[model samples]
Target: MERLHHHKVLTTVTWLLSIIISIYYTFEKPHDGVWPRRKIWHQNDKFHTAFRLNSIIASIYWIVLFVLQGGYIAHLFSGTVEHVNAACSVGSHFIVNNLFHFAFVMLFVRSYFGWAELFIILNFFNLSSLYFRHPGYARFIHTPVVSGPLAWTFIAIYWNGAIMVPHPDTLVARIFGNIFIWSILVYGLFFIVVYKDYTMGFNLSVLSAAIGVSQFLRQVVAFQWIFAFVIMAVLFVATLVVAVPAATGRDIKFARARAGDTERAPLLGEN
Candidate 1:
């Protein structure tokens, strides 16, 4: 309960925990997969340095955003904001649920990251319950803006952070993780697009506002259960179809190299 009052604390903690989790995923190979035998972190020195510098910039960006959007967070917890009857408009309920889910998303990123259904569900009810406060611009501040790319971007750096999925060995985990990973990935793209925009204006706040219209399209207009399911299925199958052959191809190349089966030398006349 005390945690609700300190959103900044929540932000910092989430980022810090994510950083630790990333370290594990980056260096330690899991038993379930082929472990990398080389020291890869040092392989790309230039990119590594760039990543560190940009990570700092990303940190500064979040601190500034937390300050600017601090008030909207109050609406989420104040509990006194008028609550609307979701039954009146099921669409409104959908809008508010998505908004709240996305709005506090950074704070709740771990929930989605771990595929925590109860956590996500509770958050949806809590955020939507408060957001529809009878209804207006106040609601927009919740999901489309907060859960939108601009605000939800705090975790973009770790979009591939879901390392603890249902485990690849199980069919259900494979399908579930694949679909869940693919769904959240739509938001991951926001980071790349918005970061590109950052190159133009060099301003984080500007990027946030710039993302508004796009968020409206994604959150309010186009995204639906059926649409998401179709995309999820495609991504799932594509991952399997592409990954299986790719892995096999790599294995074949390694075997051929070991066997000294080099590409046939061109004949004297074929040069």
Candidate 2:
């Protein structure tokens, strides 16, 4: 019990500190000559590919994600058996994620794309391990807190790669960028189809919109934004279809008199 208390406290403090550092970097200069993150992103407009996300939309998405993270933190202290077990299972991940995020921000703003990519990759594996270790596959809170960041970072790998190489608005680079943009759709669909997770789909859709908006704003006569909008539409429709069950015109939970069998059986068996 004492150990659990310490773990929760550690995670909470790490979360708070990470958020503070992130906000500080967002608005203030990291040092004497370093520009704020937004400025760096804008100043490097030439380096941006078709995959670059809109800063404003991305900021809104981050705000929503962090809010969901706070909910996850509160769940840890709920003291219920399920909550406690969940905290014990994956609580350490929160701390690792915070640390990696802090490092990534620092490295990214300082123009250390290689090291920043390394941290993002490490964070990806950290979150992946947490997902596998915890039994809650697509549980409500777990989806956003765990899967959300995972999906974002998966896209970040590509986005960071593009910037690192300074994809100079060349035909070859633009062609590859257009082709690679759909990878986000593939990644989001895999989880939505396999795990019945809409949060991943929703998050990725928002990202796609951000990308589309950014591309359109930057290059109005390009195919990249069109592809992004198409991807967004497909993901949004898919998420809606998968999330809400069709009207079966019946309540199936108690359809069987002996629904609670000694050996568990799949719901709605073939008649």
Candidate 3:
């Protein structure tokens, strides 16, 4: 019990520290002369014109989702509301971390890359703790959010690069790999526009590949593999459905159109 309290305290402190760092980076002005104007301006303009818009929308969506769904979960587990709330809080952490990452990416893609990569490593450690110390909490929290279609969207994006890498040794494998890779990359690119980083996007792709390979080995090593694959396929399709519309909405044309004719305004009183 004492150990659990200590763990919780540690996690809370880490989360607070991360939040502070994220805020600092978001508002901090770039060091003078640290970056060339062309690159920085280009990225900054892109962020202001496109990526920031998408990220704001996505963040709003997740905020609404967490409130509604999290409330429902809380009601269902009324007897263990504290436990459920804790788990839900963890899920919120996941969303917030991604949001911060997107914000960073919008400001500076290169810096975002390194920071996002470090966050992914940190998440692995976080997951380990949830998996072992609070199995029920972890299962309840992750199964619904992380293992579901929404979660898979993130996974697909992460593994996209690996899938795209050619494997001509086997035609069947090649075809499957291409499909998986393309699906992930295309979908991921959409969210990448909104989130402004490729870290979660890349990690999702990696997770997909790992799951695929694991399922394949299970088939050869055990008879129950077929059932597992079938379930995975259903979940994958569901994830596709949930993610595709959002991905399509992020297209440049769609964004520009939705943004309306603000760009047509006269520059420097030329009109």
Pick by lDDT: which candidate is best?
Answer: 2
After best superposition, candidate 2 residue 115: deviation in angstroms? 0.8
C-alpha RMSD in Å of predicted model 1 compared with the true structure: 23.9
lDDT of 2 by residue, 167-206 (tens): 4467888899989998988988986676556667888899
Q: What is the model-wide C-alpha lDDT for candidate 2?
A: 0.71
TM-score of model number 1? 0.26
Better of 2 and 3 by TM-score: 2
Model 2, residue pairs in steric clash: none
Q: Worst ten-residue run, lDDT, model 1?
A: 262-271
Q: Model 3: per-residue lDDT, tens digit, 74-121?
A: 433445544534544455444444444344333343434344444444
- TM-score for predicted model 3 compared with the true structure: 0.34
Candidate that beats the other on lDDT, 1 or 3, i.e. the better one: 3
After the best TM-score superposition of candidate 2, give how far the Cα of residue 269 lies from its true spot, in angstroms. 14
lDDT of 3 at 54: 22
Q: Which stretches of candidate 2 lie over 4 Å from their true place?
A: 32-46, 133-140, 246-271
